[model samples]
Target: MSTSAPEDFAQALAQRLGGQSVRQLAAVSGWGRTTVSDIRAGRHIPSEAQLRDLLMSVGADESEIASWQERRSAIITPPAA
Candidate 1:
């Protein structure tokens, strides 16, 4: 499996947001503006619920959402020693 950094996934999501402001996306996603901003800035990795909300709000397809979720899992999962 090809692995992508969480920052790259975050950047893709930000680009998918198009012209929408972070504040606007937060409103649409029912999350705090700071949370959305942090995600966009790659300072925070979104929880599954947050990811779902973001994908839905931005009308992301199932494939895109799945790809992001997989990337997220890879980032958070501990590596074998």
Candidate 2:
């Protein structure tokens, strides 16, 4: 697990996609390269729409998408902290 949920998501995505480049993925996702780059670099935490777009672009299954969403929620909301 990463210190941040965004990092965890980015790491998992990188591993899942193997050698695919972020630029290529961004092209496929119809999103800006910088957005993907920011996400992968842990410089940006995606909004819900962005998350859904990213997961769908990567062909992530329902469960994986849900898991990411849950992780995002947990991180953003925290536990009364």
Candidate 3:
């Protein structure tokens, strides 16, 4: 992983889904080469529900998103670190 923060990750996703060259989109989004390649190859951007469902279907943990959401909320509400 590139150690990009969660906020950057969110912004990258937003911009990639926004208007831009698909190739440039990967660089801007800070995604791994493989991830970008796979996405471009048509791995659909899964919705939160779909992702959660998929995680459960595959017997993987899905609690991390909740933890991330909590951390994001704290960052939003608290004084800057």
Top of the candidates by lDDT: 1
lDDT of 2: 0.74
> What lDDT tens digits, residue by residue, belong to model 2 across residues 1-81?
336665776677567655657888688777789987887666787787777777777788888888888877876786774
lDDT by candidate, in order shown: 0.84, 0.74, 0.45
Ranking by lDDT: 1, 2, 3
TM-score list, all predictions: 0.81, 0.75, 0.27
Candidate 3: deviation at residue 7, Å? Answer: 18
Clash list (residue pairs), candidate 3: none
Shift of residue 73 alpha carbon in model 2, Å: 0.8
Clashing pairs in 1: none
Candidate 3, residue 12: the lDDT equals: 43
Sorting all predicted structures by TM-score, with the top scorer first, yields 1, 2, 3
lDDT of 2 at 42: 69
2 or 3, greater by TM-score: 2
Model 2 pairs in collision: none
For this target, which candidate reaches the highest TM-score against the unseen true structure?
1
Off by over 4 Å in 1: 1-4
Instruction: Give one digit per residue, the lDDT tens place, for model 1 in 2-76.
Output: 546776777877787777899888999999999999988778989988988888898988898888788788889
